[model samples]
Target chain A: DVKVTQSSRYLVKRTGEKVFLECVQDMDHENMFWYRQDPGLGLRLIYFSYDVKMKEKGDIPEGYSVSREKKERFSLILESASTNQTSMYLCASSSPPGQGSSYNEQFFGPGTRLTVL
Target chain B: LAKTTQPISMDSYEGQEVNITCSHNNIATNDYITWYQQFPSQGPRFIIQGYKTKVTNEVASLFIPADRKSSTLSLPRVSLSDTAVYYCLASSSGGYQKVTFGTGTKLQVIP
Candidate 1:
């Protein structure tokens, strides 16, 4: 079974404090993503990394940044946490889509709920 | 990425089959339909996927017609543990495609 693990299940941070959320996947997947889920808004992509040291901005990347130093690890960083940034953060990983494959399913980790106080 | 529409919520009884339908009128030829299940305080998990016609697995079945405008997910003999939010996604294969998730259908299984 594919397993994705996050560093924290719940986190509370003060305003203007730096917060780091870590994620790791054991399936040797090549693609990793970070998303935040909000009520009514659904899931919005924050950032994604297709390869180590390579990152791309998603739809909502304004207040967030990501790091992929190694293949198995991807981290989300909040330069300065704010109340608006508090939401459920999710990490997902999937292998590159193969030819003739119907879909490339993304396996997700247990989410990290971050609260900026 | 293709836009998807699903019902907001559904209710079912234990041991009954549940069917959820999703509409994607503009689905591209290369795009595939996928379904995901998510529990409270947890991340979403892939349930099934299909391009067209019918696809079945141990957990669920996906039915897509020729026009590909809509698809249905059939969950057999559901239980209380099956109560969760179901998301339907449409995406093209190849490379890294950014997927957009809309408000999914929440299924509540009752005794």
Candidate 2:
């Protein structure tokens, strides 16, 4: 089975602090994504990486940044954490890009609940 | 990018079939329709995906019309545990880029 593991299940950060959320997948998938889920707003994509050292901004990428230094690891960074950034962050991995014989089904991790105070 | 719209909520009883429809008026020819089911505080799970007419799997089914502007997700013999939010996504690989969760249809199963 493919396993996507997030570094933290919950985290609390002070305002203006630098925050890092790490995600690692055991399977060597090429596509990885970060999304923050908020009530009413639903799940908004933050960033996605199709290959190592390659990244693309998603719908809500203003306050967030992502890194894909290696194929098995992807990281989401908050340059200056704000209170509004508090939400449930989910990490997911998919097979090679455009290879969603089933429309790019993403296998997700449990998620990290971050609270910016 | 094509935009998707779905109902806010729905109600259904156990053992009944539930169908949730989503509208994507600007869908392109190559766009693929996908459905996801999300539980509270958890990430959404992929249910089904269809490009043309009908696609069925062990969990759910997807129905797309010839116009490709709308799609329906049908759940067979839904149980109480099946209560969750269903999201409709339309993507055409590259052109249809943005993926928005625009108010997915939340299904509440009643006993």
Candidate 3:
């Protein structure tokens, strides 16, 4: 079985403070993603890394960035945390997509609920 | 990536089968349908994936027709633990296309 773990389950930070949320996967998957889930708006992607040192912006990438220094670890950085940033953050990892196969199933971690005061 | 639409919520009883349907009228030829289940305060878990016809796994089954415009996820039996949000996503293999998740269907399994 694949295991994806996050650094924190709950976090609280004051406004204008910088925050870091970490995620790790044991499956050595090539793709890693970060998303923030809010009520009614659903899950919105923040950033994704397809390989080491390679990152791409998702739908909602403002005020957030990501790091993939190694294959097993992916980190999400919040430059200036605000009250609006309080939400559940989720991390997921998956193997590279095949040429013609529809096997891009992503395995997710338990998620971290971050609260900005 | 294709847009998917599903119900907001559903109700079911224990020992009863639950089926959730998702519609993707503009699904492309290479797009595939996948379902994920998310419990409260937890990440979404992969349930099943299928392109056409039917595909069954140990946990659930996916049924798709010839047109592939929609898909149905069938849960054999329901339990209290089965209550969660089910998200249906449409994705294709190729470039780096970000997967979009809709509001999803919330299933409340009552005893």
Candidate 4:
């Protein structure tokens, strides 16, 4: 079974503080993603990395950044945490789409609910 | 990017069949529609996927029309455990194709 783990299930940070959320997947998948889910906004993509050190900005990448230095690990960074940034952060990993498959299924870790005060 | 949209919520009784619909008007030719179920405090899990026509698995069924502008997920005889947020995703196989998600339909099952 594939396993993805997040560093913390719940986190509290003060305003203007720099925060880091770590994610590691054991399946050695090539694609990793970070998304923030809000009550009415659903899950909006923040950043996705298709390969080591390669990253792309998603629709709502304004207040967040990501790093993927190792194949099994991806990290989401909040440069300066703010109260508005409080939300549930999710990490997911998946292999590249296989032949005859349009979209590869993503395996997600238990989300980290971050509260910025 | 193919943006998918679903209703905010739905309600049903136990043992009743439930159907949730999603729209993806801008779906690309190569894109396929997939559904995911997310329980409270848990990450989403894959439910089903299909390009066109109809496809069925033990858990649910997916129905897509020829135009592929929309799709529906059908759950048979749902139980209380089936209550969840169902998300619709229309995506393709590019190494970096953006996967767009909408505010899934929250299904509540009553006894």
Better of 2 and 4 by DockQ: 4
Give the winner by lDDT: 1
i-RMS for every candidate (Å) is 1.4, 2.7, 1.4, 1.7
Task: Report fnat for all candidates as fractions from 0 to 1.
Answer: 0.90, 0.58, 0.70, 0.74
Cα deviation of B63, candidate 4, in Å: 1.0
Error (Å) of candidate 3 at residue B107 is: 0.2
Q: Write the per-residue lDDT of candidate 2 for residues B1-111, one digit (tens) a residue.
A: 779989999999999999999999998776788888999877787888888899999999899988888999999999999999999987555532456666699999999
In CAPRI terms, where does candidate 4 land?
Answer: medium
Query: Candidate 4 regions off by >4 Å?
Result: A99-102
Candidate structures ordered by DockQ, highest first: 1, 4, 3, 2
Candidate 1 retains true contacts at a fraction of 0.90
Q: Write the per-residue lDDT of candidate 4 for residues B22-109, one digit (tens) a residue.
A: 9899998878798999999999988899999999999999999999999999999999999999999976765548787778999999
Model 1 C-alpha lDDT per residue in residues A25-84, reported as the tens digit of each score = 998988899999998788899999989999999999998999999999999999999999
Query: Please, what are the lDDT tens digits per residue for candidate 3 over residues B1-111?
Result: 689999999999999999999999999887889999999988998888988999998989999999999999999898999999999998776555788987899999999
lDDT of 1 by residue, B1-111 (tens): 689999999999999999999999989888899999999989999889998899999999999999999999999999999999999998667566888878899999999
Error of 1 at B108 (Å): 0.9
Flag regions of model 2 displaced more than 4 Å. A97-100, B93-96
Clashing pairs in 3: none
Which docking class does model 3 fall in?
A: medium
